[model samples]
Target: MGNFTKWLGAGLGFTLGGPIGAIIGYAIGSVIDSGVSVQEYKSEQDDYKRKTKKRPKVKSSTSGDFEISLLVLASIVIKSDGNIDQRELDFVRSHFIELYGKERANRAFKLFNGVIKNEVSTRQVCIQIREHMSHSSRLQLIHFLFGIAKADEVVTASEEEVIRKIAGYLYINDRDYGSIKAMFYNEADAAYKILEIEKDASIDEIKKAYRRMAKKFHPDRLQDIGEEHLNAAKEKFQSIQNAYEKLKEERNF
Candidate 1:
């Protein structure tokens, strides 16, 4: 996360394509000077040319670009409540440090601050992320944004609106949105929605949802995302468990 000038281009494996790459170009390049050596990055200008001459590229399963997108998009949620709160900044910093370690986190913080100061289009960002990210990864990203919005311990009306907009633009399914939202908010029908079952669904149906969601969010199932996100997935796993427990208690199961 040092001066991205050295590692911002294809030479450094930042090949998250479409709107995401477009965003990186403007977000990191506008304020930072190019430090990429001519010898290494010289072919970057003809990126499209090379692609046409070569085989169709396969998207990387590596989480590198996903991690970068998290930092950049988290900043958007931070600024959603009208003003940035100190507690929110601390929360984001702690998550950053935990994931990237202190040195890289510091550099990421500097870059994130610069990013939020600009007028970023959330819809455009979502389009990019949706195109490049896997379904499970998108779920994780929304969960991360909710963590940021609740940093001050409460998500304001404005913040919920923004987060919902983000999920919508990401082409995220409505059921997925309901499931994730139920994890944090205490709405009366949250448990039912979290399971993605009808209020009048049979107990067997509820049980099916519980297992499906649990399997979907299990930490072991997410190992491919690398270690950094396993804990986040666990948080979601527990929430799904809790919702099922609530359903059982309500039904005297």
Candidate 2:
């Protein structure tokens, strides 16, 4: 078997079933071709199903599950604007390489090429993810999607619409969605939005909002997910800090 097939077989968990599973199964079939036997893939699914049936409830997402879900969503967002830019594709590829070494990133891109061909049902995929992933992880997923959308330096209307739908389906409230979305834009109120506050709020309210946002976007909350995600969380946490600092300077507090 090929390295990508081996990694796919071992890494996936809850993503081995549901809409996400079906999408990934199709991608695997398309990409691996003769590298992986049908029985071997089915056996892995059966093993996962049996293990899940024995458990009390569905567990939080595994890193493998997160990786595949990210790829799937990235494909959806990349196609949303009707025209796929190479820079956006490069961003996804390089981001993966940075997060998971060159070898694993190459394997991921092979699977991603297959995924990009399929038309995904964004709502179903997001629902499946919402049911399994933690809130913090879901937040991180939104942050990453916005990064993908803005990779070309301009987020198209279509791309923003698709991502907004995804956030809603994933059960991310407006405040949280706006906060992550604002991180990619340079509007006058961007800092206030990132902190989830109004511009006319008192200095005390701004301080309170900063503390709340800082806690919500804290890197430690994602420590259990993985080091790669923890690093991403740090970027998000820093954004909150920068927003707070900006507001503080503006208010002279």
The best candidate in terms of lDDT = 2
TM-score of 1: 0.80
> Alpha-carbon error at 220 in model 2, in Å?
1.3
- All candidates: CA RMSD in angstroms? 4.7, 3.1
What overall lDDT goes with each candidate model?
0.72, 0.84
TM-score of candidate 2 versus the correct structure, residues matched by position: 0.90
Q: Candidate 1: where are CA atoms >4 Å away?
A: 1-18, 25-58
Question: Model 1 over residues 1-253: C-alpha lDDT tens digits?
Answer: 3334433333223334555455554455434435545433333434433432442444544455666678778878888878989888888889888876787677667657656667778888777667656778878889888888888989998888888999998888889998998888888888998888889999999999999998877778666457877877888889999899998999989
Q: For model 1, what is the alpha-carbon lDDT of residue 190?
A: 89
Which numbered prediction scores highest in TM-score against the true structure? 2
